[model samples]
Target chain A: MTTLTETRVDEMSFTSPKPKRRIPWGSIVSAILLSLGAVVMIAPFMWIIQAAFGETARAFVLPPRWLPANPSLENFESVFEQVPYGMFMFNSVKIAVIVTLGQLITCSTAAYAFARLEFRGKNVLFMLLISALMIPGQVTLVPLFIVMRQLGLYNTHAALILPALINPFGVFLLRQFFMTIPKDLEDAARVDGANVFTIYWRIILPLSGPILTTLAILTFVTMWNSYFLPLIMINDPELQVLTVGLTLLRGQYGAGALGPIAAALAMAIVPVLVVFLMLQKYIIKSIVSTGIKG
Target chain B: MSEQIMTVRSLKRREAMAAYAFILPTLLGFLVFVVGPMLASFALSLFDWNLLTPPEYVGLANWEKLFSDARVGGIYVNTLRLSLMVVFSNMTFGLLFAILLDSKLPVLIRNFFRISYFFPYVVSAVAVSLIWTFLFNRDLGPLNYYLGLLGVDSRINWLNSSQWSPLAIVIADVWKNVGFYILVFLGGMQAISRDFYEAAEVDGANTWQKFRNITLPLLSPTILFLLVISIIGALQIFEQPQILTSGGPGDATRTIVLYIYEQGFKFFDMGYAATLAISLFAIILVLTIIQFRLSRRWVFYQ
Candidate 1:
């Protein structure tokens, strides 16, 4: 069963278990090097935390204090006071939730149809959708903004949420996953008198826990971290997502207001960070799947 | 016989209808947001409209202006430089990180390094830019501060200077995106069977030789895949530079999309923005075609 978790690694020519009789210099070196790289990768988060709580609020500081001289929650407090940080997070969460949920529903159904159903123009329609995967969102940015204006979705979360609901990548990913499902299962369901929709909801979805989880986590991450859409679609602070709000905060507080912006950055990053930490396995699995097939 | 055929045809039609019903939501959205807007973007490129006045047909005037605009050249140059720098740096570091992560470590430790490295990639660009802005602080920026410890006389400001701003943004862009490449490379690495290494070892192949002859050859497909994606994505890079330098110190960090945003929204040159958008699309499309054409020579798939 080529479930999404299947790594699809080919028959290796190098699987001999090395005799670790000596110092194992290679492993040690790799471990040390990897740790250092991870530190560099993670150093920014540490700085963000320290700066969020640091007493120093300037943009340019010499002999930068990696450890804070005096740590405080003042920056976090000020972030809330200065901008509606809470509202931005809430708005972001709301839109992300809707988009993720909507994508799961719409994309799953479409993927199921694409993968399993036989229709006259199935190949043609699938080709159309796949061709769109290459088209950059910026190609349609100005026109999309105008269309949003025409639909009265301008400055509304719908502008962010609606376009997000039908991502080609999401559809493509799920369709690929669905195509991997065995025909025997559907045959079994038909033998039990389950209709197409019933089989989809009951058997397919339930059986697709791994791929669905992968899709959900990925969709949420993309939606949460999305910047360009919200930056363009909504102008109001109340409606703007966290990414756009933090940017606007830069404009408002100036780059010099480092402490509060870090605090805001910390706040903005927490939700997605939490999800990532909790569901990282699925996330990694999704990437592996995409890498092999992409 | 005719009635029986009609019954079967009607049943097939019912199945097709059910399929369409399932796909309708996505199809409608694709029409409205993706396809329709793309068509409209093309149309808008032909005319001058500021969203207030009725669109006046300029008949290729916008395209003419796009080619003639001096800033367009500068913008493309800056964009190409940034994209090439970021994509190359990200791929190299990503391959390094992937190699490290793929080595024989405790599975838990490997997972930790893998997850932590990708933390920045998951964070929003605005937030990443914010954190980096603090880290880039001239007086107390951690980077210069570290350099100071190395006795490098380290008072450096990256954001404001036109000379350094592009590289600064490139660093942050690489940081933001390198995690993705690492994931891709690691995935590609994992997909390579250990049999190749075993064969290489039997042949007494050195580490670099094994990697080049076996691993690198096999990994070319992934590299080629990433080449396409990273370049296409690099072309549309807007948010990072926008937040980092705001095209700073005089158009130094201004990428193509950033320029598009400026033209369409800030300058209300919607037609010009649309033209740039189409130009950007054409460039990406042409480049993608070229990459595919060239891939056959280098990319190896098993």
Candidate 2:
């Protein structure tokens, strides 16, 4: 009755047709428009890759080279030689990994409590947590900067890592996932005299694999690409992450160095794209589920 | 019975303690990072304070300056105009793409195009900005390169010209973000039930009629959600303008966020910056509330 692919799009909510009919002209028109849209959407990226491989900064010369005339690895080579690109990558990976782990643990626990465990003021507290979503991070930047400065956290990775570990959306996402699980299992665990922590660690966490992994990916990508916070907090060149470091290459290296900068840019973009490709389904599901419900 | 009651009370208290333990990290984080800063920001906005020196009690002086500042008005208008353009194009095209991809086309063909479209979203903003910066180059940029092929004689340095800088920012930002919006729209499209379409088909409803009567009504909620978010996100446009344009070309690309950044970081006018931030925050808050109120009328949950 079911297959893996079928389960993948459980929300498709459409049934297969019995026989083929004439090509829907209306659908065809829409498809052409969509394909055109896809082209427009994707062209910039294609152009970037093309330009990155060009032998010179003259890649942008009129009758703009759509395809690289003499593609070379010179840019890639120079990217490594000129800047501490590797160090920036390491910092990004380090911050992303630690922040992802922290958020997974913290948000899971909080979500479990809100979804299953009832306490005095639970509704009010959960509201407080979700309400944070409405407020933009820009609103917090100035004050957070002051607080971080007071705590001697300016120009430090802790400023970036710590704040990221407590995102409200993760908690909300995990809670929604938790609510969908059957309650009978929790009751059984309670009857066995398992404490809340034990029940959560063993029963709840095991069942929440899909949502947890989803949260992890979202957290990792978001933290990895975070620019503004890193921009404001870590001013020291040494403390800069991938985005900040890459930005410096543009300003300092000048237009002549476009090849190397483009190479580095390609390198910076590749990892996230790789991760996205691997987990496209989960990412799509996570966003769709949360956004539609909200 | 009395003994059992006492045991149950003890159990409830123990459960409460566990709940607190589980929630402590996130709660404390909220208080420290979110609530604390919000209060501090409000206070900072009232006083003429730079980090290096003690703050003077300026009262509403910063707020007053924000209202009187010509630069503030200019930034607001530019940001608003750019936001509207982004929101319009993103939603209009995103929904259309979702509907097309949801057709009976080969799954591989559909998915390949979808992936191709989304390829740009995963790239870093800095990277996208760099790529576009090259394209917007006056002499060597491919935009002019292509325009040259079209028989246009004069070449415009898109980002260097006041009239074009803001438009350039919009084009760059939309290119980077359109994929994410497409995915959002596609997700919503897939979630619609087949029964409605089937019913419409049986009733001799053509594609247009079916879409107008069934799909459009059902998809309104998703559209509304996207619209509100787009409006909010568009209003806060920063990175593209900051990186690509540097809010330049005579400040034509200066958004509200950029203005705040210039004041706070570059000029060290934290007080004035806070005032700008508060103004920005209030506008966003009002817009969000208005959207939320309006949703009840048109955002069909079912």
Candidate 3:
């Protein structure tokens, strides 16, 4: 009688048994599927890196070897010897840096005015700026190429640097970032007799480190990888940046030096990889912050 | 109040000056580079000018040639087909993969996959094209080797077939770029509130039902944005086709941009090229307008 009473008591405490801790089937399946995807996505890059240090003929071997036994830096040596590799690297670095700096200053100034200053036609002007963003870069390429030719900037680093420096994306992105700051900070600066220029330079600019970092990375990557503008603007072989340089290298290899090209490709990725590693935090932040607005 | 008004007026003038100063570089650059060239391309389009000689005004001849040019239609069709295939497939798969990634998984594993997918977006186009070329090679390529193992004919010239040529190009293009759209979709998915899912779960809704009722509605705006931008971008497709095929085995893969590049640079037919540019510009504009108009019926924003 006592045992029967205890069983009834246990039954009373138990409502519906929590659904047998459902096998985390979803997580396991997704993990497996995504891992496969990761492999597929990363394979080509790996292949290229292998091919870069690979022998021209052997690089094309069926069953594709993931590891090259005789990986050498000869391809890199050839890239330096056969082409203006150093000059190209220097051009890319110099142009990207100067353009990034130029964008930071010019875009920040314009963004500050749009975000803070109240002026007549401010809305209209800002609208025009934003609308310009929709105009495809290709539409402007031919005209810009001609303009560069006329200005004697054709086949020069300036042609690459100048057009990129005045990016609408930079202006727009910086303005959005600047708007996030509380107005009270600027007002406080103003009441302290800070001029608009002084306020922007001293207070507003300093507070915008993260966004500025984001913009810097964006501008750097865009300019660094840009091909068409440089293709049209720079005709001289020596003036070629890495994109054109790589193209030239591809042509020179003529289907034989896959390993060297792969190695060269691996070399090509170093700057981008460096930049990515350095500012990955800001990159994620910028992308995430934009999603909230969306 | 009077003193504030005076300060406001001075500030307005100061702001105007600052606007000019701030916009000076951009406007000057725009005028010199973009606006100035746009006018020039228009004027150049009316002229029979090679780089070697002064431009001779040829009126409607360039446009006339463009309409009747045997190759023009082929180029247009190739470009349109490629763009449509890429835009549709990229969006479809990008959304699917994003959904998969957003499912409950280990944080480290998920982020690793996310970064891996995004790797292609950062790599050079030339490298990607070269890599695909090797993979698609008939005799030595892994693709044929696999086909042979499956008892299928291994002699297929993947990039040589006029019909399959465009498909091959499209596949490569999609593989390289789907990650970018995936990132966009993932961002959209994360923005959706968990409460919606919780509510659905409480209602005994299945995953598909929850996705249809809740996820798709919330994600539509991002989808619309991606759709329009992708359409616009795909229309100007150049690098991959240019490098991989050079429009291949005849003009099978020649895109409008490639056509323009050929006309403007290779043949130095600036007028003809400019005419091609204007046509491309019109098509892109129309597509964008259509997307904007269509957004009203489908796109849901909260």
Candidate 4:
């Protein structure tokens, strides 16, 4: 009877074969639609790249060429010749670097205080900082412009850099990250007689490599792409950043100079694209976590 | 033991002082830049003073003008229209893309799609707008060229016509910003537990029913957040219209911020501009509060 039962079980197992693999039609459709959407998303940049490298006259022609027939560097040369494109690029880099560094220092310190240390009015101070986020920059634009001019900062990079150095959002982001860090390490340092600044610099900042990098990239990109503030504050062509400078270039040349304009745009976009591609994981994560625009 | 206690107390005091020192820069900046300027702008609204002239007390003159200003009325309408279009398209497309991305696909292809979608967000608005101008060009732009091939014969004056210019601004703004909404929504959707979907499947729920019952409620908070921010951002749009149309075809796309800039800088009506700025601030504040209050009805915390 035992031999018969064993044979029956074996037969049952053998009779029931594995299921056949079915084609994932849903997934296939999704992939195709997604791929098409992705092409549409990047199509503008593709057009710009084609125009930037292609002949100037071909930019407006019917049945626009997706690929440059004879690529050349003349449009790029024209961008520099037409305006101080290099100066604008340099100004953008300088201002972005200064503002990013300044925000990291100021925001990190403030965040440490808010997260780790206790003091009088701590909650009130934090509330004040957060409230400022709701106040649109336009509310301050008129007075800030007046202040900048009064302080001899008009038409200067300092006007652009000074106001952005201490972002409330940055402070809030850093504070949240700092609070997530375990207190045991900090307590150990305190037992060893480490001072507040010492602990912040050595313990908190070093452990905060990821958040700090995120904030740095966010601030850098914001400053690099800032247009309105620079447009209002700086009247001098020499002081203008890339965004304002590109507009000036367009204003001077109008639609007739599409090639040079495209070249300048390519120049402006390439550095940002390179930075973005390299650190995209962190950038996307930061945007998701903070809800801050890049 | 008393001496040791005193030493600890002193150490705590020192720590507090150190904390104060750490926050001083931000505190000072806040006071100088944000707080001071806000107060100054409010005060400046009461006076008429261009940069080159002595101040004259306006005494609600600008306020009265703002109410009666016909152009201001039209400009506000245009601004609202543009914002509505942009917010609708952005949210719809953003949610669609996020849902599409949530489907079964290789991780590699997912990243590629995400990066491609988000690439334009990082680029300068001015540069992108400049390129858009070319694309919107009447006769030679690829947009019209493609349309012609698809059986349309006439060229659309996208930047020149009042009708088309606002639509063009909406397109450019949505193209640049929808990526952000997509990522945020994707993040929110991914955070939903898979167990719920599996349970729904066990109950014989179809894909749409599962999504409608499980995903929508869970993602409500994210949707609310995006709606509030997108409305605020859309309302204050400056670059796309300023670069594309320059509020052209007669104040068609002149946003509140653009109008403020023009009043303050172009015409140098400083007092009027301050009043406009205050109105914008009030509008945003009210909208944000209303959104939060309304979110209580629909937004699910979990």
| The best candidate in terms of lDDT | 4
Candidate 2 to truth, TM: 0.91
User: Which model, 1 or 3, shows the larger TM-score?
Assistant: 1
The per-model lDDT (C-alpha) reads 0.83, 0.81, 0.78, 0.89
Q: How large is the C-alpha RMSD of every model relative to the true structure?
A: 5.8, 5.7, 4.1, 3.0
The residue pairs that clash in candidate 4, if any, are none
How are the candidates ranked when ordered by TM-score, highest leading?
A: 4, 1, 3, 2
Q: What TM-score, over all chains together, does every model reach?
A: 0.92, 0.91, 0.92, 0.95
Top candidate, metric DockQ = 4
Give the higher-DockQ candidate: 1 or 4.
Answer: 4
Rank by DockQ (best first):
4, 1, 2, 3
Worst 10 residues of 1 chain A by lDDT: A4-13
Winner by TM-score between candidate 4 and candidate 3: 4
Model 2 alpha-carbon drift over 4 Å, by segment: A1-35, A292-294, B151-154, B202-204
Residue ranges of candidate 4 with Cα displaced over 4 Å: A1-25
lDDT of 4 at B184: 91
Q: Where is the poorest 10-residue window by lDDT in model 4 chain A?
A: A285-294
User: Candidate 1, DockQ to 2 decimals?
Assistant: 0.54
Docking class of 2: acceptable
Q: Which stretches of candidate 3 lie above 4 Å from their native place? A: A1-13, A17-25, A284-294, B1-11, B147-153
lDDT preference between candidates 1 and 3, better one: 1
Error of 1 at A92 (Å): 0.7
| Docking model 1 quality class | medium
